[model samples]
Target: MSHDLFLAAKAAMKNAHAPYSKFPVGAAIRTTDGRIFSGCNVEIASYPEGWCAETTALGHYVTGGGGEIAEIAVIAERMAKVTPCGGCRQRLAEFAPAEAKVYLCDDAGVVGTVTMGELLPYGFKGGILKK
Candidate 1:
């Protein structure tokens, strides 16, 4: 199951628009309801406007009526493991539980797996925004 998710991430990587960095990345997420969404990094001319693959995938999931990510997989570069960036980690923490599995992979295959909590300990939740 997760293997397939990783493959989806890899497939999405093919569509990345990273002309500047040349570091393409892809991300896939499986919802608790069993739906899957995948996205590739999109780099814009303005560097600050570029979006990470994980963030794009999450946007797709939400747009498609998915909620509560059961698991996620990220694939990038052939030689080294690439995990989601700090902002992506925070975005993921919003939908994934503390114990949700996050697979880190490269072109070869999955190199590591970590829980959402491991990536972002004490992540901010909705409670923090209550006024």
Candidate 2:
């Protein structure tokens, strides 16, 4: 079921623009409706100001008429199971439900899996902001 998402992530990783770090990363999001959106890390001379692969994927998801996110896949050229960063975790939680699957992938395929809640146990809740 997740093999396609892994493939999308792997393909996106190949297009990453990380010359400065030389570490390309890719991310893919799967909507509940089976739509897949993939993105690669884009870096510039401005250092850490560039967006992450997950962030880029989220941008696409939102622009494509945001839907319930069911699963996610992340991959990097250097790390076998590179999890989303702190900010990316929160960003994912904003759209994906707590039980949403997050797949960690290596060069070959998915190496591990975690839930959105597991990724950010104490993350800020959007509901709290509305209160």
lDDT of 2 by residue, 1-131 (tens): 99999999999999999988889999999999999999999998998779899999999999999999999999999999999999999999989999999999999999999999999998888887785
Compose the digit string of candidate 1's lDDT tens values, residues 28-110. Answer: 99988888999999999998688999999999998999788889999986546788999999989988999899999977777
Question: Model-by-model lDDT, in order?
Answer: 0.89, 0.95
Error of 2 at 37 (Å): 0.6
Candidate 2: Cα lDDT at 116 = 96
Cα lDDT of candidate 2 equals 0.95
Model 2 alpha-carbon drift over 4 Å, by segment: none
TM-score for each model? 0.94, 0.98
In candidate 1, the residue pairs with backbone N, CA or C atoms under 3 Å apart (3 or more residues apart, or in different chains) clash, namely: none
Specify the highest-lDDT model's number: 2
